[model samples]
Target: MNEGYRKDIIRYLSVLNNLGGCHIDTINGFLQKPSYIGASPPVSLFPSSDGKSIGDALYQLSIVLERMTDNEFDDTTFYHSKQLKSPLGPEEVRRLNEISLSAKVTQDYMNTIGRVFQSYQLFELLSSLEEQHITLISKALTSIFPMDQSITNDISTSKQKNYQGIIEKIKQLFSRTKIELFLHLREEIEESQKNPHKSSISQATILDTLDIKSSEYYLASALRQLLSTDENSLTTLVNELRKIQPLQITQLSLLPFKDFYQILDLQANFIQMANTYQFFKEDSNSQFNISTASEIKMPSTPEIKIVDQPPDKAIYKRNVKPAPSVSFQGDSKDLDGNYYVSVALLRCNDFSEEPTFLNGASKPTKITNGKIVTFKKLKVMVTSHQQGETLFCFRFDLRRYSSDPETNPNDFEIVSSVHSSPISILSHSTQLKSTAIADLPKVTEVFPLSGPSTGGTRICLLGSNFADTPAIRLKFGNVEIQPEFFSGGTLVCNAPEHPPGTVQIKVSNCQNQWSVTSATFTFEDTNTINPSSNISSDALSNILPESVFGLDFSKTFDTNFIIKGLETASSTLPSSNGAHRNYSKQY
Candidate 1:
């Protein structure tokens, strides 16, 4: 019996793995190869939500199968299922296989050690809670579809409490959304029950519509999702379990298989629709072979990585490949295909990416060839978390925030820019605290300011407040080059790579306060070799000027210090040479 149980669970996993991309309501045995020898039903790929739900169930089953195998009770694993080689291309097949492997491992962590051993208790607890929930949902469902059965929230479970209100709220929410499919399924169930014995509807069809492979797996997976969302579901169930005496659990554990299943089926509402077939079918199926029906497309959103300061390179830093740039090109749309207000994380401090968590861990400051921060367009609709005065964006910085005239509007004042409309959050003045907004370091003199374009100049900054403050950073044309040393009224740092021209050298303090110098450093080109120095004396003399013309300074600052030909009254000016073209023009 135990071996059969394990086999049944593994085959269910195979079904999930193969048709995991299909919507939960569409999952049925015909979709899996072994259930019907003929052609299978065409299955559409599930949206991300349903895919996650189905994958999670398979993950849980894999865990149970592994545990049962460790005790040497069964040889069944989804790996041992009989299927031919996959028809999917190599990359898609590889990714699908990896998804299955990763999901099982994730479930291992999700099912905490204590909960894994008490699986049956947790399963029963969740199912009992959900049966009450189903009763409530059925009320909301029937109200929307009055032609269906006369289901009511009035049939409350003994342990259930304060659920009718929840039903009303669910009804209001579902009435506005695409939950029509659910109502239609309920209608289908009601019509099929008119002749219960001769009903053509298969058990798999009803189970799929209820969105479960088995009652235990469905409740378990729903509880997992609820732990992140409706956390009260888990809390309520666990509290009720705590009230149960150990003797009751021991009795439940020792009950005969038939008696236990009978009680289990009685507790669930969907079992009524699937009464013609075993709730947990124990049939061996073909091994794993990925099909083209499920195509797992990679998501557009990048999993950003924080790159540490890399080793210095010869190429321009910005031109070098940078860390990921996070984008939300489609964030404005809500789940219901309606537009809502959106917010972005804006940086205010001259330095970027402040650590949010307790530890100094944060995202990397490095980004592609442009600035790291920008504003994202907001969505219009507001949800609960985004009540009145929605947080359309988060403005952050390593230190203090000062509006940059370059990044701000032309007509806007930098000081008053934060208070403007469209971009809120700067309006609060009561909580503003006085902290270190360091003064911009003054540069009275820059010793050896000039350097080669190759950039190895040892430049000393002689300015006020140039002491070794922890956040002092020197930027030579945007690239922040680290300082070698800093002392009272002095800063020593290396020049960075630049073209053969003067660049604005700026000083930024720990507070992101900055002051700019007008082209303090001049970069000279040193790539040319002097051919005159290498030339021999004879060769040099041949190229030397025959005579020199001196510009007399006697009439200094006068534009008309001219030279004329002597006795030129009847003499002709020098004739044009063979190589020169001369022409007379009438003015």
Candidate 2:
């Protein structure tokens, strides 16, 4: 009989001992941690006391053991493991301790009406209570994890129910918890829109209070939906997460945007371990049936058509201005409501890549004549499109979009796509435009042709067909600056500091249009010039090779000094054969 009892004890203890790892630790710590109210025990209902009966004694013993686990008896002179102070009084710890032992053996045994059983039954009772304790902490606390108004209502309306009914109730509570978490996250996201820098509640606090382990997929889907609606929420959440010391976001600050996706992906893998504890099951063989929860319905793919296709050649000035935009029209009747519409810019070469398809649950869906037109798809835009709307305009944000194909074949593949026509998109500076040379602006002359290399020299540039706009710039060699003031035929600008040499001057409208002047401006070094010293013509002809090769010595002197020590050197140095004063070397 003792052996049989030991087997039962071992079996129950095995189940009890299995409660380890992050899930159980998280739940236990969550229960043990101080609530917003105060630092209090998990429950007052199971307080230790001298029992009225044998069953009552068992309950008291359970409470005593639990308090031992909580280290309630530990003090300056004693530890619970080595020497424990009894709850009844401050007494030295022993198996034969006076107060607690007398209460358990004499008072409880005499008061009991039933037959006194073997000591094995007591061990069995203790194990059973422990199992109940685990269950109480893990399951019963689900409805009151965070202890909000909703939980108060649940407790007020609570009643006794059957086993199956109780299971259903727990499941419902889990669903409600998920909903509350979603609502809280939505509120944070909305608040972030008003003040992006506002710190949100910590995710650790949320994870502890919300019981996220049981509702992983639900919470994940909620987060995914939230991201789909407002992408800025992710940025706000990430910033808030960076505040957590354990996440080690100090190192993550240097990580690229793609690394954030990888971090999220790793966190998402925890879904596989979600709801792993099976407290309701009788044994390992017992099947736990979980009814499928309702999910967010993904709307059917609408037939997308380009209503107002962008020009064949669109100019994107990077971040200076808004990116290229195209107006698209989707079937309003077919689409039930507004949904996310993603736009891609695919090159002409992408259409001829190996055929690929968007892998769906049932079958692969092809795009654009089944030629895998979105192989090298650059996802430039994502905008919300509504039904019955005349047109949905998507402005491409190509700041992160890449046109290059993956060097690694194992890279992430796109599963859903829509792309624009084969269009050549060029940057504002690189875009080619045909303009007649005769119609272009011409720089005829520049007043005060020379200025000190110390800069701050006001000069007037005389030109023809000069753009009468503030956008016009006077470019001296590689250095460019906006005019202080400009008109149709003339503009004035302060000379930017340069080396003591002549640089070709030009008037640029910044639209890839330049009015080149045959003349140049000389930045004479006043400090280096000596009117009394008469240098021979042969000595003045010996120019530094750095000036000829355009070697920049700006770092040492640090003033955009492209050429140095050429205060009196002429623009062209005479050759050894004395051919022409126009001696120049084209490097």
lDDT against true structure, model 1: 0.33
List, residue by residue over 224-292, the lDDT tens digit for candidate 1.
Answer: 222221335434433443444232233222221112233344344233322222323332223322221
- Across 505-534, the per-residue lDDT of candidate 2 in tens digits comes to 887653455764544889999898675886
Q: What lDDT is reached at residue 476 by model 2? A: 83
> Please, what is the TM-score per model?
0.21, 0.20
CA lDDT of every candidate: 0.33, 0.35
RMSD of each: 29.0, 31.8
Where does candidate 2 stray beyond 4 Å?
A: 1-434, 468-471, 511-513, 528-587
